[model samples]
Target chain A: MDIVLGQLFTGLSIGSILLLVALGLAIIYGSMGVINLAHGEFVMLGAYSTWLLQSAFGLPFLACLVLVFFMVAFAGWVVERGVVRFLYYRPLDTILATWGIGIILQQAVRLSAGAELRYVQTPEALAGSIDLLGIAIPSYRLFILAVTAGLLLLTWFLVQHTEFGMKLRAVTQNREMASCYGINSSRVFSLTFAFGSGLAGLAGALVAPIKSVAPDMGTNFVVDAFMVVVVGGVGSLLGTVASSGILGGSTAGLAFLLNDTLAKALVFLAVVVLIRFRPRGLFVDRVRR
Target chain B: MSRIKSPSHAWPPANSSAPPAAARPSLPQRASYVQILVYLAFCLLILAVPLVIDDAFLLNKYARYLALGLAAAALSLSWGYSGILNLGQGVSFGLGAYAIAMHLKLKTSPVHTGAAGLPDFMVWNNVQTLPWFWEPFHSTLFAILAGMLLPVIVASLLGWFMFRARIVGVYVAIITLAMLVVTNLLFIDQQRYTGGFNGLTDLAWLEIGGVEFDPYSPTFYYLTAGCLSVCLLLGLALTRSKAGLILRAIRNDVDRVRFFGYDVAAYQILAFAVSAGMAGVAGMLYAMVLEFASPTFMGVPLSLSMVIWAAVGGRGSLLGATIGAILVNFMQGSLSETFLDTWQLILGALFILVVLFLPNGLASLIDMAGERLGRAPPRARTEEPAAAAPRAMGTFNTKQRG
Candidate 1:
């Protein structure tokens, strides 16, 4: 039972990272009608940015995190303006184009960093383990939980209770209607894409301390994120959170019992089955059309 | 002739293709019989090159290209004709290749030195005997059947779900990519059976009917060429059929085809199954040719590159896919061997260029130029034949395929 409880906490920690990645994907897909295969690249860039700031500039962790997000978010805006704006009507082309950009970015990173795995040090505040009852839990894992929860709150506030959030949601639901009402959908699109990419970047910075910081690190995370999006329901951020918990927890719990790769496969199969049964996912807005 | 003289001269300006429309004398609606014969002869010559090349290395290397060509043709059949963009074809290829890899690996096991045995990889992973899954693959006939049927069945199921949900565009692409990743992880983790990251390797020659089936032998080359021709013929025949034309129409406008009383889902699923089966056949040949199968075969990059080859060859032209795959493979092989670590950058740049500049693909360049030179007014001679007409660049402007 103690081992079970330990595995449960581990699941929550893994779920925290997945929540960050999948929320970014969900918001972007909602706003831009793009399944950005390169979204992972943003996360990757964030990690690299964090590494550069800390290692080269000798910045503190909090300052480095902020810089990484801003840097990658700016890159995301440029990508939206340059490559993705031409592809709104052709979603599949956008998928391919972003995939191309991802390959290029990954290769560029590989060239710069070499293929070897790099490491990022967590701050002294978040280091070491915490004893809970009879089980010893990692403090960093608990810190991730706090950070993820805080961000989820921040994301919800920005999307639901703010004027800019209203405009973004209005445009997503009906671009023509929103535009007719004097909202600039294109600007909204760019902002949302950038915001989503920035969030992904933040995820990378946060995860690099724990996970291996490598050029292709996004490849592993993106698969899990895609599964989260599909199982949660594309364009539904709330469902994304719910699905990530389900998938992430189950996957981590299984990994404790089985191999990590096997657990990943099992999660994927479960999601495929879930999507098969509930095409719109467990929670979706009721549509009159 | 009078109708042609006025309209053909005046057409490129209004159409806005900005292409070779201004260069050539207008081709007759009916191609001369000799032109057809010449093309057939050119194709014959291409076949003979593989045959007459005395160097076994060159002959067999191109045989591998022929395998990819077959896979590309399969992609065009589903994605180009049916408008399905079935991204899981590589998954099927990997599935088939893995099947044969398992068979070959099992056949050569040291455990089999004294008795019928499991694969060496399986044994290395601590299996004393063949696993339940390995049972059917032990027989050559059953392994082939499993290889072909497994992909078709899996694709059929996937197609049923996706088409039924009316998922199109990026959604289907995501679903398929999801499948590819899931399947790869499953295979990689089932290390007891699949051999994990090291994959199934060190494959031996296939033997049948008391004949030694050396992978490098000319007999395999002939067999590969025969299979390529057969797959190509089947793809062409399907495209030329009434069903193929309907599939193409669905690609253009799904709603209009639905209005025509066709079951759009059925056509798409059928096409997906057919294409998946073709990929499986190519995968089988690839396993035989390369004597190896690994997870990379089904990687997302590979799945995307197959689409790249089809697009670069001009998806509308069936013959172009064969040429595209072979040419692309040749360039990839030569460039990678020469440039080593830098080929990916070039390949990515090439992919981007093809999408942006020649959306109709390289094969369409000749067609565009021929029409412009043959039919355009003499006043347009100063214009480049390929770029004289205005270009169409949008999803709505997706060019027709053969």
Candidate 2:
């Protein structure tokens, strides 16, 4: 019973990180239909930024998080304006172009960072573990869970309630209609892409303490993020949240049962089967224009 | 080239809404004199390479490049000609390589008095009896046959599942990518049989009818070049066929092709299978030249590199794709050796630039020149969406389900 609870908590924590990564992916893909294969690189940038800020400036982890978000968001914004904006309609081209961008980012980091794994120090306040119901949960993980939930709620409120969110949603659903109503669809795409990138950056910063920060670390996250987004369904935020939970929980549970490689294979196989049955994913939005 | 009748009588108009083919001007039937000259020049250059480079190691390296070029051309057949962007092509290639590697490994294993020979890795793992899967590979003919068949069979299954379910475009790319990842993991995990991360190595020289095809020998280079030439010609023949026209039509509009009474799924599967079979043959040639097979053969990076090769060479043309693979890989080899630290960055930047600006690839330049010099109006290449970017954005937003 104790072991199960501990694993569940671990799953939730991991799922929360996936949610952060997938939310940005879902939003960018939903709004622009540009599959950003460079998203994992955005996360990698965030982690590297966090490490740089912590080591160079001695900034607090929370402060570094905010800085990394903006930094990576700015980088994403540049990528959008310079490269992705030109390829928005060409989904396949966008994929290839962004993959190229990803390779560039990874190689750039490898060159500058000497291809060595870097670590970020967890905040002093959240360095220890706490006991709950006879199961010990690491304080950092609990902190991450709380932060993820807070970010999710904040994003929901922003997208669901704010005027900019309304514009973003309108443009995503009907670009022509939204443009007719004086909404700048291009701006919406740019902002949405930047916001999504910022979210990925935040996830990277949060995960830095636990996972080693390396040039290629983002590759793993991007694959998982893609699985989460695909299984969650495109153009659905709620689906992203729900699918992340299912995927993350199952991954943790299976990892505990089988080895890591087998567990990953099983999860991938399951996702493939799910996709075979439900091409649109677990949730199908019925919103009519 | 003249075997197929004039397009006006032999084929329907490409666009369903357009005027009947009989009313429009007839399409050109054969490559222009300039195009033929260019092809001959390329062939001559390839033939003259060994004479110019003399060093056996360098000759071997060029042979390896040509083998990869053949694999890249196979990718072009499916991705460029058929519009099925299969990202898991290395899965087929690697399977073929491993099939041949297994046969080589089994042959070199010291035969026991009472049992079939066991691979060293299997013996190391305390595997008592040779696994059932490895038994048939002991026969060279069976191993070679299996190498060609396995990739085609796997591609058929994958293509059937994807096309039948109407899962295509980016979805096909994602699914194929996932499939390759899964296969790589499986290969790595079954270390006892596959030799784990350190892939099968120390292969003996492949012997054919009492003659050794040693890697250092020119015979091996000739072997690769022969395979490459055959595969390239095969790809060219298919792309120029009436069936290739139908495949291009399917790419342009799947619904229209179905309306035209063609089974789009069948065409897609056929293209995919043929491409896989070619990749398999390339894999066998690669293993023979390199003397080993590794999980890296099916890795995501190599798979993506194949896509880049096709894209660079002008995915629209078979010869172009083959050239693109050779050029990029040759550059990669030389550049990486010269500047190991910055070569990947340069390659990545080059890829992005190619996709962004040179959408038609390096071949388009030749085509443009041919048009100017041949004094013929630019002929429309296959059904590729010429100016796909801006128009695509509009359609994407308009077609959004929500």
Candidate 1 per-residue lDDT over residues A98-211, each given as its tens digit: 777887888888887788888888998888888997899888888878888888888889988999999987877766678889999889889888989999999999998988
The alpha-carbon root-mean-square deviation between model 1 and the true structure, to one decimal in Å, is 6.5
TM values, all candidates: 0.88, 0.92
**Predicted model with the maximum lDDT:** 2
Score residue A47 of candidate 1 by CA lDDT: 91
Worst lDDT run of 10 residues, candidate 1 chain B, spans B1-10
lDDT (Cα) of model 2: 0.80
Q: Which stretches of candidate 1 lie over 4 Å from their true place?
A: A286-289, B1-46, B109-116, B132-139, B208-213, B336-338, B375-402
Regions of model 2 farther than 4 Å from truth: B1-27, B32-48, B109-117, B336-338, B378-402
Docking class of 2: acceptable
